[model samples]
Target: MEATFEAFVRARGPALLRYAHLLCGDAGRAEDLVQDALVKVYRRWGPDIAAPSAYTRRAITNEYLSWRRRLTNREVPTQLPEPATRSHTDAIAERDAVWRVLAGLPRRQRVVIVLRYYEALPDREIADLLGLAEGSVRSLAARAFATLRAHPELRDAASVDRASRAEPSP
Candidate 1:
């Protein structure tokens, strides 16, 4: 059990953080969320969990949604920082486009896309973790990708070239 817990932490901790960060868009909050999820996971780790990472990810996702569901008197910013600043390669423009489209999507769609692309999980696993139907996962990803493909901002190849040219040689 000790070895199992340690191995689980070492292997899945980073992945959990990635999912958390994508959902919360705040590093500190993401860490807290993942920690909270890990505690919940610890309490349930006795037996019959065939997929520990999936179980933990569901916990994290549920926590984020629960926190968001709280009716707050305060306003929250919904925008994510540009994924463009993340890269200097020609890929940066396309990647940034993705973020832009991702930002415009509904929260559920955004979460679905992040889990599918970032974790590289299949639809069935995503469904199991998210408590969503497999068909919902497939449609959500498809619609999100279609929206991205149709977004005009992403099609400006010149902008990609511009970003590429702006990079200094390593």
Candidate 2:
């Protein structure tokens, strides 16, 4: 069955927000991005938009790309204000380190990684949303993974993953 925009948002809004946050690296900007994308999606809503989540995700991605373009054309300072934080646990620190690495990647690579790993979408779906060939999507994912694997923080994660995999389930 098809879903309405409001219902979809209500169900999936947090996931969309997380996607945007990963794309842009700021909570405020992510919220704005999601809002802007939803506005566009709401306008374009029709019977043809059978998959609201896919349509919304494409809109969010396009909005982020457009925002980056505008930011590049401006003379604003590159510095961002530091966010307030409480003492972080090891898990939080690990996630933040991963996010730092993700935020460093080029937009296409970042988006490809996020969609493939975080959203768990197939290559064909990612290609369709990004207007990329399926082979291009696979190559992008491979390159991104290579880049991520080279990071020191992720090296630790790789060791942890291996160790966990070697352990039998309780």
Q: Which candidate is the best by lDDT?
A: 2
RMSD to truth, every model: 7.3, 5.7
TM-score winner among the candidates? Answer: 2
| Candidate 2, 1-170: lDDT as tens digits | 22666788899999999989778877788999999999888888888898889999999999988888688543222223344356745555666666777677778988887787667787789999999998998788667666666788674676335422332221
Q: Which parts of model 1 are misplaced by more than 4 Å? A: 71-90, 150-152, 157-170
The lDDT, on a scale of 0 to 1, for candidate 1 is 0.71
Question: Which pairs in model 1 have colliding backbones?
Answer: none
* Cand. 2 TM to true fold: 0.77
List the candidate 2 regions with Cα displacement exceeding 4 Å: 1-3, 73-88, 152-170
The estimated TM-scores of all candidates read 0.71, 0.77
